[model samples]
Target: MESIQPLIDKAHELIQRADQLQSKEPSVRSVPKLSKRIKAELNFLHTLQSGDVELKENQLQSTNLTHLEAVLSAAESLPGVSDIFSAKHATDEKGNQKTLVIDVIANHGAIWVKVTARRGHALYRVWQGEGDYGDKDIVEQALEYNNFASSNPVKFIVPKVHVMFLKGLPSEVKGELESVGIATHGHVLSNTDDHRIDVPCFDWSVLKELKVIHAGDPRRNRVNLDVSTMIAMTSNLTHNGCWFDYPECLLINDQAIEERHHPQLTALYDILKGKQLFACSTAITIYKDIVGNVAGPMEQARAKMLLTKVRIVDDCVSKRTQELGWSNKIKERPKIIFGTGDALEMVTVSANGSFIRSASKHNITYAVDLHQSRAFTERKEAQAVTIKKDDAFKRINLEQILRDLLNPS
Candidate 1:
């Protein structure tokens, strides 16, 4: 017992360090010397656990002659074999049921062990869009597995990337995992147990196509002639120079939106927000415009039903976010935005009528181009409305100004 004291102490230290490594999200490495020592201890533990008692047990247990020498060779080492096993994929008499089985060895008897896992359960099937389109890559941003890892003590993560969707199957989605050698490199969670996977599990490109379809509305009339009323409102709110906040909800630059030529995406968001949008009639007319300056004959005949009334949903910005506009986080054209009613429109369109309380934003999972979402580092030429020089006037609402400017008859 005294002789084995060092090994016991090393084992305890390794276990403690391993616990630390497994708890962090970024996977901090243990001190190099300690990591090496821990591996040695784990290996030694495996060897001792499979010592001589296993050797005799394995010899009497293995029936296959071909592996008899190999078993004996391993038995001679400090790490003696506990059992010898054979693996094969077997089918039933009718060849319908199939599974992999290995021989199990015990002091009393040997029995065939059924291998339960299959290619389907190996996790490769997940990214194949097996269940739904948009559903596959959409899960990338809001991955439950990654969130669970953040909560779990062990910090294990199912790879969020490197998964490919199989287009061949229409009803059920599948993966092209064989291209990455995931199928052939089975039987272990890690291809090599160096505490890291040689290949990255995520692919940014595969996650880009989150939505399958795009939609919008059409207009029946020529819309407004010129938006001077709105221009006055823009001047009223901007005070000639100020910044305001705006969310990325306005539909612009296409998440593959149809050649959307309606009101700028922000304008639509404002309509949903329930604040008065004060824009020039001429500008408002464009809100009714459709793609190609015209629609398909179906729409042409329906007289642009798709363009008449714009729809707003939760993706629309609300009062809390728009308050930044009042503060000029959105410095450019703040006045024009206020005149036309983009932010208030967003709240109205996206929220349930009775549900007006502000809550934490729901994390909608989707992959977006990082470059496209970059924040502006330097101030560009100001399209923003003028603001009062005093910071104390920041909370001033644009609505009263709009009523005064656009509606002054």
Candidate 2:
């Protein structure tokens, strides 16, 4: 703990004194020799100072690793966690390969975890470090691991720390992490005995009977079921009832009496005859054409039957609705509240990626685009584990999508 700087300074002073003495008394042969010795000793002192700084750094690194090991050990002891291993690496923004710790599978899926010994300002400093050194590495690694072929999907890469500030993680930090699909845990003081893994609660099995209809062409006049539609359908099904979304465009364009009947519309109406059907108020406008001399008797009969099943809803609070007004007073009087534009926008992104949006203010739990187009497929927000059209109907993908939709965090 003593000052090594004083010794280094003293050595430098001696070297200067010896150089001056040698210049003043050149004939005194030992003076030049003494200066050489002093210079050599100064260099040795400098080397010792360099080694001392390195020793302290190594000690700090060793302490960090010790804490990380403790965290990993605690994680392994948690119920349902197994096969814990490490030495996995990810590239930083500077292309430096940084090693992460503790890859494990706990109850659900594979998780790549990074353990941090830092707390409060230190932890935040590392997270906000230049060129994506801390949090970025974890995200990059988890994303890379997800790309590899594996049966168990990687849910998220977590940063587990032993301690945090009394108020807990800053909202900004938590928000940023969640935005990029990262999760966090372990803010308690370093106590392995009381540790618990915070797994997300979701009933993925509810989506087992989910039906996905994909239209090959984007321009095709197919049933476009949005997030509100999916939530209505799934919520009803969860409660032992059936519900469906019948868009106004589909119903108006596909009206037919006999052999030329649209198979999709016919099938949808047949499946949801006695069950609940959600449609925009515009759907009720078809009744005018049916009642007037424009429609045949068969069309009028079909329109009357469909009107009884459809529940008209105001999709948004836009001026367009105000301008058009409600077409049918009897049907659209008690309009069901659907959702806001922001909720729809969030669901739109979630539907494309099959990723959970936990920060959405609305109570939207699920969304579906039955006739998803190429635009949805091309979104950069789509996850690496995006369900392909072919696999969209698969039980596993359905379950995953449902879990994502229902995840509260």
Note the Cα lDDT for every prediction shown. Answer: 0.27, 0.33
- lDDT, residue 310, candidate 1: 25
For model 2, how does the per-residue alpha-carbon lDDT over 1-409 read when each residue is reduced to its tens digit?
A: 1344655565566556646644643432344444455466556556656776443444323322233233333333333333344334455678775664434333322333344333333344444564333344333443444333121222111222111122124344555555655555434323222223332322223322322222342212212233323322222111111112223233321221111222222223333333323444432443343244443343344345434434455455323222323332311321222122222221121122221222211212222222211111111122222222221111221123223221111
Question: How many clashing residue pairs are found in candidate 2?
Answer: 1
Top candidate on TM-score is 2
lDDT (tens digit, per residue) of candidate 1 on 82-118: 2323222333457563433122211111111111121
Q: What TM-score would you give candidate 2 relative to the actual structure?
A: 0.25
Task: Name model 1 segments beyond 4 Å from true.
Answer: 1-202, 216-235, 239-355, 358-409
Lowest lDDT 10-mer window, candidate 2? 371-380
